[model samples]
Target: MNNENIIDIIYGNLGSMTATDQKVAHAVLTAPKDAVNYTISELAKVAQVSEASISRFCKNLDLTGFHQLKIQLAKVADDESSYYDEINIDDVQQALTNIKNNKVAEISNTLASFTTPTLKKIMALINHARILQIAAEGNTYPVVADAIYRFNQIGILAIGAESWSTSIGQTLNLITDDVLMIISNSGESKALLKQIDVAHKQGMQVIAITNRKDSPIALKADQHLRTSVRQYVLNSDYYFSRVAAITAIETLFLLLIAENRKRLSAIQNHENIISTDKI
Candidate 1:
């Protein structure tokens, strides 16, 4: 099993965890190293729960028991340490090397997590949709804009809204043949969630590209593409770079081209038009 899945499993189910189970989850998430060293009894005490509660937590994560949980936690701890050790603040060369390595890992992890069926579903939605609208906020705006550019280059009727009001206005106009794609790292944007509700009510399909699979936006989307990247820091509150999200969008762009070979001609025509200074 991929040990990284432990983090996803814990975070994805956080909303459904009981108070006691949440204690166990918090203990593990906050101090995974310390949690790894603890025995079942030790963890039970640390989490202020009974051993039975600890076992139930393990079961919820699909682990056999406490022992398996510890093993996975240890793996997660080791991976995090490696990520930190690879970067050195004092050395520019080392920092660049670490940055390149992290980006490679981020892209690899994002692509590895995608299944063929999921890709097919995404391609189908994009290819069949009569209209494509993208919604994003803050740092994710450029990513969504780039997606709109790519789709438009391929002769797809894609557009992006820059503000909440515009998003709501566009969502209000959506039809059953339309698709709304929202890009968010946290996937908890209140405005996006509201737009998603409106889009659903209008019979439009929603697609989410986000880091958290169980985030509110992801949960509400008809389809979600998850991007797995290491968090920016030890604290869960920090948002990381958009490298993973961009990579996922670029991958989808490539798939869209592959799905319709005629898109290559359209892209070339677009490039030729730009090269001659023709708008």
Candidate 2:
């Protein structure tokens, strides 16, 4: 079946996939053109996934085998260029359409970067930690505030320290299992890097959400969740959209919320107390 929505399902299901299946998904989804030409073994190497994992990935997608997976990827590749264009020089009406497409693409691609296992690990860390320290600067601070608020809602003690620089002292004082989450677009901010190092030295579980998978923060953090996006520039200033990062945070927030019936009941009780929807 050459369902056109297959690619969307593939990309969007990354957070729900087994870590092994996620590897295969990331490999092909990252570069479908190269993937379409890859033999099963080659794809296995590229995705760092075993052949057995690929087969399982295929089956999960309801495909027969690797051969069928290749064919589907190829078919989807051929049809993809018809709509997914990067350049947008349209009138306002068409610009609306472009914005919609770009946002959808950003959200899809961001979600594609996560694995179910990693998200579960993050949930464990957050739930067990005595404090959740969020570090961000400039454009990323809004993300920190959102993270702290949501974490608080989930009954976790959390704060935004502007950046990790402010948390080093607290790290020495807090429980050893405190978690530090970083939201940075560049992931290379010198201050942030130093903070990551400090957190690590203090034995904190440090995680990062960044647009660059290879950036220092991503590489150095205990866990990295990526939200890389297509670049857009206008009037000589780069337009960096946080839509993907926001989606990633929301996904984590919801997953944390869904981790157990206890959380669900707590949320219900909490909502019963504070939410204005009672009217």
Candidate 3:
């Protein structure tokens, strides 16, 4: 195992790991190259475990600490997926083409994260949830509105909260059967964790859709749905998740409609009323 690639070594020991250790290992193995770059606190948060647990896991792997684990991971980084240093200063035409290509890849990768069984599980959760509180901020609120509209059409009770205050307010006021779906690309930021913690305290299940599985929001969710793998250089200040996260939300809405077609009778009813209002 010592001579093996760090990723491979982690995989090899998966069967033997304790549940807590496996959680940490799963977080790292989700994207070894990306995990390598994550700080100890970030990795711990993503793993939904303590930093001390991470240190113990490192020791179990014959490493001193998180730093040593990162050194090992770097040696086995996936260069094929790594384009951090290859900054694309694309001209107008190239930018258009490149952006389209990246968007296509983004949707494909986002869908790849879901399997048929997982889709069924998510749909079942939505069906059982008393209310779907879809939360997002800034530009992502449009995606939240879209999801809420689609869910309502299918007879699912949902509300879109575009502000953080509304997000936390739901936890204080909503019932346990409510599901809090948070869509954010605030990777590594602690801003949304407070909301997730509040939701948990209220006994609400959370569904988090984000660009990074290792993101704090993604890790803390009862159901963590991920979007396209984002690529950006270390310490890069600009990361917008609009397209990829939108694609993920749209995918889930379609799946819900497909799985719960019996609910579609409500869609026709909604259309009839909405048509009357328009005329």
lDDT of each: 0.80, 0.73, 0.71
TM-score-based ranking, best first? 1, 2, 3
lDDT of 3 by residue, 55-149 (tens): 99998877778898998888757642222222355576775665566556556656766667766777777889999888877767888888888
Better structure of 2 and 3 per lDDT: 2
lDDT string, candidate 2, 166-254, tens digits: 65566656656788888877677788788787778777889898876556788899888877454345522234577877888889888
Question: Which scores higher on TM-score, 1 or 2?
Answer: 1
By how many angstroms RMSD does model 3 differ from the true structure?
9.8
* Model number with the top lDDT: 1
- Tell me how far the alpha carbon of residue 60 in candidate 3 is from the true structure, in angstroms, after superposition: 18
Q: What is the lDDT of candidate 3?
A: 0.71
Write down the RMSD of candidate 2 (Cα, Å): 10.4
Candidate 3 positional error at 53, Å: 24
2 or 3: which has the higher TM-score?
Answer: 2
Candidate 3: pairs in clash: none
- TM-score, model 2 to reference: 0.66
Model 3: how far residue 115 lies from native, Å = 3.1
lDDT tens digits by residue: candidate 1, 1-279: 354556555654554578888788877866778888998898888888999999999987778988998888777676552232245577989878777876776777678778799889988999999999999998788888888999999988998878879878988988999999999877888999999999999999999988767678988998888886544444233445678889988999999888789999999999988898754
TM-score, each model?
0.77, 0.66, 0.64
Worst 10 residues of 3 by lDDT: 79-88
Taking all chains together, the TM-score of candidate 1 against the true structure is 0.77
Candidate 3 versus the native: TM-score? 0.64
RMSD of each: 4.7, 10.4, 9.8
